[model samples]
Target: MVMTNFLQKRKSVRDFKNKEIARDSIEAIKNYIEEIEKETETVSFKFYENGSIIYNGLKGKAGYSGVMIEAPSYIALMKKDEEKESCLNTGYYLEKLNTQIVNLDLDSCWITLDNVDDETKKNLFGAEGTKVDYVVAFGYGVGKKLFTPETTSGRYTMDQIVFKDEIGNEISADELETTGLLDIFASVRFAPSHKNSQPWRFVMEDHNVVLYMEKSDEDSRSLVDMGVVMFYFEEMAKTIGRYGKWSVILEDQDKYLKVAKFSM
Candidate 1:
């Protein structure tokens, strides 16, 4: 529930103050990146100290449509290769790093470089820039705007996502609460995904939770979304004294694709 509350309050800041992060804070972020990178070698993070170059080059080029979130600094995620596992790991660790960014009293938003080409990426970010799929824009917010109504996305409930033993069977709310997993599910549902698609499901069988990703014909980054949810689920589970390492099982089925399993 505590984790859920933290997630519920977590929002992407599209409007940031036109200010650079402090020198100490920048060093702290670089140090955090080093600390975060060691845990997952498949995904590499690069810090853009002067975001002007990145923001200038990527402006009107990448991001959700053509608008890029202008921030004082940026962080790019590069996968080792074009592997599904690498995509998942990229999502997982990106969220992990974002958590730290939030903890430091900063704001961040995930930006996809889908529309950008490899040649442009290399020119903008150096040779390894070609491998970058996602970059995060993080900085201090311009503060809440007055006379401006904020827009937020909606999340699905357990009955819509959690299934009983398999993909199609329905899992009741009573079963989830009795199993002491009600809070875990409630919290993890808030995990951020691409366009807030939240294309993930759970098949709980024999007290173990099996993760599945609903194939989206429109989004190619669903595997990355899978990894993002896995991080939050494990995090919320630990607060309730549940612990398990995810064993990735990316096998596709007729209805849903099996992503991973947690035997807790």
Candidate 2:
């Protein structure tokens, strides 16, 4: 299946059957990880067959807020350099991998490892400078991979999340349709965020899309969330014959943190 089809059909599966992913699927995941590592130099991944170690730490963890789900296998994501860009790259890279997993006829859920104990961190990926950002559980789900109304998991509509050339001015669906970006923006709206905060806002410039984040005083996981949305935007754009690359902009640092500009 194409990435766009998977994007529309995929739902986060919290329950999985007691079965292993096919060896070929595992191989495909590893190969894709290698490619993503090359593309995003700061990110790295490791796969674990035994989910008990990670699952145990997730139990009653405050950071994860007791929402971690169990599965037969897990993928641990780590970053080499602890910088702002590294966090963004972590989300960007993992979502790409997640999309690939969906395309492979598998199910996955992004599991937060923020509150994992020290010992488990040491055992899973090591306790060095490598910062473990997140883990994903993947396997055959207990049911079908269809997006029901309940599974759609409501997101902020385009008017609420996107803007017209500036902040506060909501962009209408009709305007997006006229620009041939309605579908592309729709995919961005579906991108998952920490706590479903949906903290991103896009400013539609002439033939370009400038990304921004809602105001926050402290360092945010939402930066990672922004990268995840960008991944969706770029991939869906490509699938529909719209191509562009993201470039960071430095001018708009006051009203909002200028994340990137997608140039067509």
Candidate 3:
């Protein structure tokens, strides 16, 4: 599928078929990981061929309420540092790699491992250069690939999540329409976030767009959340005529984080 269509229709599969991803598919994934690693400095991907080891080790100790999503394979993001940039790139490139998995006729779900301590993560995945902050379990879903995965997820309207010049300054739909960005923003509301919190907000200027995320708890997944939405926005923008990459703008605004800026 094309990028825009894939972003709009992406679904998380929690229940996967009892089958390991084929070896050829795993090789394709490794190539994708190597490609992604070169695009950024902070993060790399580790594919665990045997998902049982990770699932068994992380069960009752990871994910929401310590409930792990079982699958036939798992991929972890390894970043060199625990800084904001590392977390952001982790979410960005991980989601980018996720699209490749979907294109290969597979489904995946993001698994948060923050509740799992460092020692356990090291012991389970090994103590190499891998710092596994998050894992994505992936395989064929239980049914047909073409069917839409049933979803209960909802999204904010553009006005609810976007602003004209600054936070609390609402940007009207008609304004976005005039700027040729209404449909793009609407489609990106489908981007996933932790517990579906969304957490992403935008402030638009004449020549630039600024992204912000709610200040989540310290060591929380919200920065990663910012990175996920950032990819969506840039990809969606490309569908139109706007083309630019996000430049980090790490700052504080009492309750929200100033994440990045993109020139239009």
By TM-score, the best candidate is 1
> Lowest-scoring 10 consecutive residues by lDDT in candidate 2?
56-65
Q: How accurate is candidate 3 locally (lDDT)?
A: 0.82
Q: Which of the two candidates, 2 or 3, achieves a greater lDDT against the reference?
A: 3
- C-alpha lDDT of candidate 1 relative to the true structure: 0.83
> Which pairs clash (backbone N, Cα, C closer than 3 Å) in model 3?
none
Stretches > 4 Å off in candidate 3: 63-65, 128-130, 143-154
Query: How far in Å is the alpha carbon of 42 misplaced in model 1?
Result: 1.3
Task: Give one digit per residue, the lDDT tens place, for model 3 in 1-264.
Answer: 656677777777778899878888899999999999889889877788899988898888976555788899999888778899888888899898898898899898888776788778878878843478788989988743322535624667777888988888978889889887788787777788877778988889887888988886643577787788888788788888788999998898888888899998
How well does each candidate superpose onto the true structure, as a TM-score? 0.91, 0.87, 0.89
Model 2 stretches astray by more than 4 angstroms: 2-5, 56-68, 143-148, 151-154, 170-172, 250-252
Q: Taking the tens digit of each residue's C-alpha lDDT, what string does model 2 give over 1-264? A: 655555666588877888878989989988998888888777888887777766766566522347667787889888777676776787788898998988888898887766666666776577651377678988988865435557667778778878888887978889888877887777666667776678788898888888987756534587788778888888877876777878855344675778889976
Candidate 1 lDDT, 1-264, residue by residue in tens: 366666767677777888889888888889988988878889889899888889999988976558877899999998898788998898889998898888788888888888898888999878888899889998998766311224444778777888888877998889889888887787677777777788999989897899999887843488889988898888888887888889999898876788899987
